[model samples]
Target chain A: MKLAYAIPAAGIAALTSAYASAETITIATVNNNDMVIMQELSDRFEEEHPDIELDWVVLEENVLRQRVTNDIATEGGQFDVMTIGTYEAPMWGERGWLEPLDDLPEDYQVDDLIKPVRDGLSHDGVLQALPFYAESSMMYYRTDLFEEHGIEMPDQPTWSEVRDWAEQLHDPDNDLAGICLRGKPGWGENMAFVSTLVNTFGGRWFDEDWNPELNSEEWQTAIEFYVELLGEYGPPGASSNGFNENQALFSSGKCAMWVDATSAAGRIYNPDESSVADDLGFAPAPVAETPKGSHWLWSWALAIPATSESKEAAKTFITWATSQEYVELVGEEEGWTSVPPGTRESTYANEKYQEAAPFADFVLNAIREADPTDSTLEPNPYLGVQFVGIPEFQSIGTQVGQQIAAALTGDRSVEDALNAVQRSVERDMERAGYLD
Target chain B: MSAVQTKRPWVGVLAWVIALIIFFPILWMVLTGFKTEADAIASPSLFFTPTLESYVEVQGRADYPKHAFNSITISLASTLLALLIAIPSAYAMAFLPTKRTKATLLWMLSTKMLPPVGVLMPIYLLSRDLGLLDTRTGLTIVYTMMNLPIVVWMLYTFFKDLPRDILEAGRMDGANTFQEVTLLLLPLSMPGIASTGLLSIILSWNEAFWSLNLTASKAAPLTAYIASFSSPEGLFWAKLSAASTMAIAPILIFGWMTQKQMVRGLTFGAVK
Candidate 1:
């Protein structure tokens, strides 16, 4: 009888020990380098808040988007914190799916966040997500090759001038292509670059009212130049290249120039990763008729879902992760070059970050100069520079991206591709009731 | 005998070539796992010095043992549950004919035609309501349901090939249905059952969609573990290849061990 009583007493103790003490919050994030670093240093947060435990669910980018969107939309309450992007933050926030981040601690320095980056993640002036790291597109070229060929790149080059340089520097016999650009067909893959191209060519996805302008003269000019430049001077099988593929191609000294995300500066400048690290140069994203949206603004931020039971604990973790102290910790441990960039004004202001990252000012200016609301020359309805803000834009953009990729591959003419894109976009907008 | 001997050597050469063609991608993956990140994407060369750095980094970054344990447990439990539910259904469908039996079997397969994404929302919501999300039990149940139709279909075909005379004789000897199944049918169809279980386990082991969607850290399997290496910036090919090699090794070994049984069972009724 004494033994039976002791067993029940021990069972109760075990049960209480498992459940009663601490709150556990699960964070669903993408598997990016900055997020990985945050995960590695999360033990500090756990130690500081002894009454709360943390769980991490790291997933790939596309998979993370799908899972987080599903969970939040269904109110499944699977993740307390979600790593979302500028594209989803405002849309989801406006839908009342995200908790407004209005009550952060005093030391969190919400005002120190870059204005454009901060604005991108807010819905009607209410912050929905905290920017962890942000980026804008730029041109990376080989200074050595430019000197060898006696070619001078402009501070802000035009698309026509860039094409001329490509024609001059392309040396297929020596196995070096003039340029490497994203040609793979996904909304985020090739269309990210293509959208910027269309913008600088004075093209918009829609007019004042919602009608697709894909078959406009400006779009045709932009796409024809893009396809001709990449086809004439790009490396073989360029149609299969995305950011990573083009990064690899450029880093190995196989491409003379690569126009891609400014986030690649760290990898490109690291001597261990790139063969041409010592000979690299930077310039603003090229333009033609305008520079209004010559570069894209993107930020991968963190937000708390409205369905989270541990909202307070989750907010504490987000504040800690995106804090200036966290930036200092990363700089100290991982080196200043590895610091997450484009989020905080203080990061760009730091002498050490400026010294370590040479392209810091250029990237910061580009991020600031990009105006998503007024991206195109004409009045438009979209709130994104590289993407459209509406939910239906994802499928529509991907369909148009495929048609553009086909033009690059020579399977279809540029005119035919744009016509098909216009038809598809009209169909999609009509189906989504965006078009009457 | 002389002509057969001459033909055998040429056939052996052809077989070796075909085998190599089929196995080259796995060989390349293992080799790339040993290369540096730059070397993996650089011009394909066979002369670089091999290193174990990627394997070290991959292991350092992830808890491989936890994911491996999850994969093993979920796959085995699902396979056992599928077998338990499939064997009786397949037996009844094979031995006891009814007018609607064929239609029922076809309908069961038609459920598979609907893409998993079409019903993903409802299933996700239901799992959340039931508090089944992120649990190993949840994954095992999903895997079992996903593989049940194929398991039942394979078992039915195998059971249909069995001689009805033996079952009738067992019935004549005063044996009931349970006794006949336990004593006579199971022993005679051991190979078939083993192969069906093996296929179910393999399918569940490599399943990524539901595992990625339904499970968080606690019950994530090797597929989810492999996916975590893919970043928005780019894939680290050497590290990805290293993780892939580790994730596939155990299942590859398990498949090798069951190869003979699978071959025998798959071809059992074909020759007759």
Candidate 2:
């Protein structure tokens, strides 16, 4: 009996070590405000689920996308949970690289997630990822600056009216630029801002038949308008500026107005983060001929990789991260302004959050109103509002963005830039067999 | 000497101005680290409410020590491995004096001309196949391959500058092939070796592409850490500068301490 009991005990010890090895899960993510909060609060998660261990690979937006894309494509299995955007969730899910996350725990309140955010992050009605924060583009202006200048900014100011206001408020001598905008040449950098501008100007990347319309009169007008506005009133070295650069410009009270993501409302309102926290005024993204696609929709969501060996552990961590409890935890610890916004309806409906964040109602309204399906004035065959939802988009959009940057620098005419963009995009589309 | 030199105080002032011009960008980045993100980008000037907010945020954002640890491991490991491989190869080319040796050196250097992106796919697949992706050992191996040719060329020049008669005497003293090479050749080339190692470490530490591509969680270095501060919409100047300062601090201090050896190696054979 002693010999038999000793053999089984030895076997149990062997199994325990193997089980310990299996408990650790690695997650690849972007370094966003919410993700950073998750990293800090992970001790709570680890204590509650002591059987699971969390490993994080936090990278920048572009680098994270490239790393996650390479990992999933190669099936390297380096990370179990990947922080993806609304752009990648559907594409990667269609490629069978991501696992379906439909069977979340009942308490996760899957139905409580905002429908627009959830649907954008799903494919064929099967949820592929969970939203950490979703956002639509909106205008953030300095209320103090406007009030001091005796300027009245309507909630729905037209783009023409915005430009007039900017010109009126311009004071380069005061170290203040009338506006701040992205000028860095990347698909997601300057192109994100430019795409929304193009939409509002009644320009589409492609027509219904998938022919590139970059050289059209509408696109020319948009490019010219952007160049003129920035050249006249934007900060110096504008060609090198991207989102973070522009964010710094805006938050310092140097920018009279900025049009960017609703996700930034939290950061801009935090007293610890922004100098102009109390003086911020929110408005809808400005429009020209069309108001339909004046804003963009984006969700920075988390998904599990199909090749993950520790699937259960990964899923558990993601669920905890995107849970309603996590939102409340962030509010309690980091303040309500820093809480992950535009993801769940509960966040918007909470009186505590509404009272805490003055920009809450405007951000929610913008997010809810953004329609990705009809993001352009003309018909087109793409899903994203600020980006074309295809693998080749990274290459194509970047090429166009370079031309736009060149135009900004006066190295090329707006017409020449648009002409080059039209030719390159059309050639690429034809080569890719998207057009006959 | 008295009249011409005394008349030109403006020349010294111009020299100082030139030095300042060369150093401005780095000084700007350092100064930006102390400012809040808002102030850093808004004015691009020295006037602002200086804050440690970005540094605080940067430290909390990621494990700086872990990344610094990986950087130290991979850079030192790769430099040592490359030295072991290149010293012998360079010795053969320098002392052995074959007609094909010059061609071989040229061929080795030519490999550096190929853009990293051109061969990224094959190398990435190979790393994956070998189960080396995201491992410190894997990065060391890749970095060794990447830095080998330059190491070989540098070591060869240093070895060539050594007195051939000293090596010949060691051979006559029955030092044997290994001893003559190890004891005599290595020590004589110490200045060169130190500088080469320093260069390799600096290059490997600053390399962003492979570290970003190969390593996700486990073996990420300071380059990837600095890169995480950049976002799509705009650049976070204060936080990025803070990350950059942290990333560059170790190597900068290392360089300062070993400046003598680096200068000796760089200026090797120049006087002779």
DockQ metric, candidate 1: 0.34
The parts of candidate 2 lying over 4 Å away from their true place are A1-22, A144-151, B1-61, B169-176, B229-246
Q: Give the per-residue lDDT of model 1 (tens digit) for A283-307.
A: 9999999998889999999999999
Quantify all predictions' global Cα lDDT against the true fold.
0.89, 0.86
* C-alpha-based local distance difference test score of model 2: 0.86
TM-score of 2: 0.89
Docking class of 2: acceptable
* Worst 10-residue lDDT window, candidate 2 chain A: A1-10
Error of 2 at B97 (Å): 2.4
lDDT tens digits, residue span B132-196, model 2: 98899999999999999899999999999999999999998999878989999998889899899
Best by lDDT: 1
Cα error of candidate 2 at position A43, Å:
1.5
TM-score, every prediction: 0.94, 0.89
